[model samples]
Structure formats: structure tokens, C-alpha cells
Target: MQRWPVLLFLAWVCFLFFAGIGLFMSGFLLTRIELASSSSCSDPLVPPPWERQSLPPGSCWAPQRFAKAVLVIIDALSFEFAHFNPAKTSPLPYENKLSFLHRLATSQPRHARLYRFRADPPTATMQRIKGLTTGSLPTFIDVGSNFATYAIQEDNLAVRQAGRVVFMGDDTWEGLFPKKFFRSYFFPSFNVKDLHTVDDGILQHLYPTGKHGEWDVLIAHFLGVDHCGHKHGPDHPEMAKKLTQMNEMLRSLVDHLGNDTLLLVAGDHGMTETGDHGGDSEKEVNLCCCVLSKFLIPPLPLQEPEAVPQVNLVPTVALLLGVPIPYSNIGEVMAELFSGDGDAVSAALQQLSVYHINAKQVRPTVGLPIELEKRRNVFLSTDLFCLVQVGWGHDVIFVGSLH
Candidate 1:
């Protein structure tokens, strides 16, 4: 071949390779959705607290149920690990380990609530954490960026609370919310074999910070369970050991927390039988959310426990902490947590009204405002009287789902 022809062929190959790389990068960048933040407290899209009559309709604040909150994330805590099944004569190694949660739910029925927390697909830690904080679902492509997480741009629970957040464990959090926490003790989370470093680091600071009242929202993300799951599948003896450690730590933490401090224990995601997660398998998606506080009322126990979306934790935490709901939140305020005695009708109506604000915040993205309006009107016209009579406050939230 002539030199000129050989050089031309090499040039063409390089051009094609670069073009393909450019196209692949562009595809992910284009499909990646970045939601606009609510920005200022005065933004029209933000909702005012239920009690503040002086503030306009769309303003900052929501009813604060607790003066402070401590969110403990036990990574990869599957429902089976946390839920106790009386029917199972022979339980697995991971099952019935976190028995304290069940005991708490039974002993303090009015003060504690437990739910099967269901995660959206792409249940990587970073993605699940994003959903847990932002009240938004993750795209499938987001899993690719699990290790290389960028700071979350959208208005999130951590940023809403801002300088009041104290965090430790899972350096992924630092990557996800850089400079957001008032005080932080980050431990490298990528080493699956080394579990105790992150968990112990969190323990060193978690209770001391909570006792001192230096933070309005204390966040501790434990990685031992997830690390154990990754290193030795959920069937291993190490899994039981880790869960027992978690149970003991939780009991001590509960004793340490004051009545005014709300403690939210959540699993960002779960693992499969083989201890792999990323996909949308039932075992992978089903996790646990145990909310403990003197400020809450437990829902009536059902034959089969109901599951709540993990993203719902965002609005639930935001409202419980008296912060404005994020602009992109799709989850409704969990009514079971907010239900109380008093003027039942008035309370139901007041809670129902928050759905209108939720609906408005989400309306712009769904692109079916007219249809949503028509469906909402139909619900109001047909079921308003029935809903009021029966106090079906949750049904009103279903109406907001029209968006």
C-alpha cells in the first residue's frame, strides 16, 4: 500500500473511534435529568407551613414534628433481616436478627412505625441515597456513576437543612453532598472487605454529636452490613454477626435519643440471595424503614404489611423537620405518621391540602395538566363527600398522584 493511502486509513479509523466515544458520552449526558431547585424560600412553588397563617400560600416552612432528627442508614438491610415472621419455623441466617425493631414496634406502638421500604430500580448506594434525599427516582444509567458521584444539584433534604447536617460513614455521601454537612467524619466506603472502619467511625461521632445538639439533622450511614453482604453472601454467619452488632448499636442509640429527637432507620437498598444488587429483583428492591419518635402514631397492623416507596422518605423527613418539600418530590406525606386525634374532619382537610402543593410542584414535569385537572375535579366532585365522611385522607393523596 502507498504511504498516503495507509495514513488516510489510520486517520479515518481514529476519526470513527473518537466519533463513537463522543456519541456515547452525549447519550448519557442528554438523558441524564437534572431537576430545577425550588431555590429561595420565597419561591411561589414552595409551600407554607400548616400553622403559619401570616405567610402566603406558596412560601417556606412546614409543620415541624420534632426539634431534631437522627437518620441512621444501615446499608443493604433487607426486609427479611429486619422483619420477624412468626410463620417461618426455620428462618435464614439473616432473618430475625434485628429483633429489636419488632420489639420496639410492638412495645411502643404509638411512638414507632415500620414499613417495607421499596426502592426504585438501579438500587446502587449512590442512586438510592439520591432518591432517599431528593424524593425522585433514578434513571437506569445513573448506576454507571455510582462510584464517581457528583454533588447533587437539586434541592435535597441535606441541603434543605443545610449547615445543620452532621454526617459520617460512606464517603459516597461526601461525594453526593459536598460541603453540605456542618461536621463530617468520612470513611472510605469502597473497600468491601474492610467493614468495621466505616461503622466504628460513625459510632465514635454519632452519639456524641446527638448528645451535644450541634446538628439539627444527624446522618450516619453504616456500611458493615453491605460490606459483609458483598464479601460473604447473606447466607453466611458474618451476616448474622453484623446484624446483631447493628441491633445492639440501635438499642443503645435509641436509649441515647431524647423524646424530642426523631430517629429514622432506613436501608438505602437490599441485596439478592447471591448478595448482588443493582437490578430490580424483589429481594434487591425490598428494604426496611423504621421510624421511631415520640411524635408519631403507628398505623393499624395489617395481615400483610404495606410497603412505601423509598423516595417518600424525602417529603416525610422534610415535613417532620419543618422544611419545605423539595420542588421535584413525587412522594406524598405518609398520612399514617401524621394522623392524630382532635377535630378529625379539620385535620384530614388540612393534611389533604398539602397534596395540592405537592401536585403543583410535580405538575410541570408530567406534561398533562389539563387531564390531571379534569381527573382531580372528577375526584373532588364524585368522592369529596364520601372521603370526608370516612376520613380517607390518603385517598386525597391518590388524587395528587394524577400529576
Candidate 2:
């Protein structure tokens, strides 16, 4: 063959090799979501305090924090959907359609507040819920568990509070909690093409069930917001309509709520601009965690919403209701929710500090003050020890999930 012909053949081979590599990289980027690893259940450093069936004293862990709790999860509800309703003075180009949640969070006496609850990557729904309910970090394994047939064996308060806990919405909970609900209207969460099925079923049943007034806990998870995201991207017209519908339903529920009831609304994970998730970008991981009630949570947090770990809710919920923190929990107690009798708040903080120290069995838990708890339950503090023990990449990893 002529020299020119040979040279062209060689160039073609090189192009194929590089193209093959590029395709492989793209596939890996699109499908794999793992960002961190976790300690095995048998990891020796894990103390008994962080295991199943163990109890750590919580300052607000008392008997019956409220008469009831209602958790309404509007899947894929991003921070912008619920937290911001730019006033006329604001400069964003689009005409701002106000959400009912905005009204509730900023009402004269403030019937509710919205927080920027952070979510970890893999932003898959199941992994997010596992993190939310168990107060546990998402392991790289959760990527598999998101589709695996395995049952979640971790301690979950929603399951523990089973007898009177009513559930309606995504069937994902059916798989995760498996027979833990008292009365349930489990609707299919798949089928993004037919968006209304799950939401309609949930809406039809939710109000009637609430009217019955026979449960201590009511959990209603809406799938429409997420289905819209998957089908039409974040900027779809249906997105706003779905959010508006959710706000109306929730507002109605709050209007009828008795003095002792608390309503919590949150997104399991946020969607990317293209309406897909499983990444660590802000739009994909920042969602809203809102609380509503007839009475004010004293010493309300900042007037504007603040960001906090999604895991923090586990301990916060446990403390609010006087339930024990899950044995394997790593969540911090959220302090801004409750107004203070300084001493009581102090005691709760101390409880969390002690629990943190004992759970990891490593020196002081990272980010906690050394003087906060004097308990010498486990390992000594060291820079490397803290990072390795947390499994969570940094001091801050989690916020709210769409669940």
C-alpha cells in the first residue's frame, strides 16, 4: 500500500480508540451515582449507642410532643418551587406565581416556615427516603439498594410508630417499610407517563382519611410533582400547576387541623434542569422542608429559610415527639424549630453531643464542641478519624428528600 493509505488507516484506528473511550466515560457518568462509602454494620468502631434498639437521651425527647403528625411529600419539589415568591420589587424576569407555602411561611403570625433541606447525590427516591427515615447516611450500596430486592433493616421511627400511622401515596414506602403502616392506600409510583394516577388516588383518599380523625400519624406522598419533572422538565407548565394544587390541599388540611397537629411538607430530592437527578448539582440536591401548625414554634428560626441536613430531621422528629433516636442514627438535632426555655434546649444539645461521641466510638464527633459532652465513650479525636468515621464526605451532606 502507498504511504498515504497506510497513514490514513492508522489515523482511523486512533479515532476509534478515542471514541470508544469517550463513550465509556459518558456511560459511567450517566449511570453511576456512587460518591462515598459507608462502614459495615460489623465495623468494630461503631458503639452500642448507635446500634439497633439502643436509646440516646435527647433533650426534647419527651412523651408526646404533639398529638399527631402529617407528612406530605411532594416528590421533586425544588427549593425554588416552595421557598421563593419574589415580590414585585424583585428583578427575576418571569412573572412570579406565589405558592401557598409562601403565604404560609410568611404569613403575619407565620403558620409555617420553609427551610432549604439538602439532599445527597444519587438523588434517587429510595435512597433519599432511607436517609430521611433512619437518620443514616447513604452508602454507596444504596445505589444498588435503590433497585435491589433487599428490605431495609435499619431502625425507622415511622415503622416504630406503626399502629396508628396511616399511609397513602407512592408505593415505594410499601417496599421500604413493608407492612409497617396501619391503613394504607398504596398507589403505583412508576409510570411517569400517566402523571395523575398516584396524585388523584392520594387526594381522593387523604382528606376523607383525615376527616376520620382516627390516626396518630398521617403520611401522604404525592407523585405528580416528580412525574411532571420526569415527563416535562423543571420548567414545565404542569410543574407550577402541580405545586399550586399541593399548596391548596395542604392549606386546606392545615385549616382544619386541630391545635396539637403538625404538618410537614418536603421534597425527597430535587430534579436537574433537564428533569433528571442522580447528580450533586444544587438544583438536583436542594429541596424544601416545611412545617405547619396551629401554634407557633417558639424562637422561630431565621425569618428567611435556612439550610440543614435532611438527616437532622430524624433526631428532630424523635425529640419533638419524645421518641428515641434510631440506634444507627447520625443526624444532629435541629435547634431552630423550637423556641427556648434555654435550660431545656441546653439539655437537648447535651444529649445529642453525648450521642454523637458514643455512636462513632471515635474521638469527639466532628463539628461538635469538645466541652459540649464529657462522656468518654469511645475512640480519641483525630483529623483522619473523624472523616473516616462519618462516611459522609464532609461535615455537611444532606438536607430534605422528596419522600
Displacement of residue 260 (Cα, Å) in model 1 is: 1.5
Show where candidate 2 strays beyond 4 Å.
Answer: 1-63, 88-98, 108-110, 140-148, 161-163, 301-306, 341-403
* TM-score on alpha carbons, each prediction: 0.78, 0.70
* TM-score for candidate 2: 0.70
Compute the lDDT of residue 161 as modeled in candidate 1.
Answer: 44
Q: For residues 290-357, could you state the per-residue lDDT of candidate 2 as single tens digits?
A: 87777666546335435677777776676566555565556666655543345665645645543543
Count clashing pairs, candidate 2.
18
Could you give candidate 1's per-residue lDDT for residues 126-226 as a string of tens digits? 88888787776655443222446567776678866434788888999988888878888999997899879999988887777777757778889999999
State the lDDT at 317 in candidate 1: 74
Candidate 1 least-lDDT 10 residues:
383-392
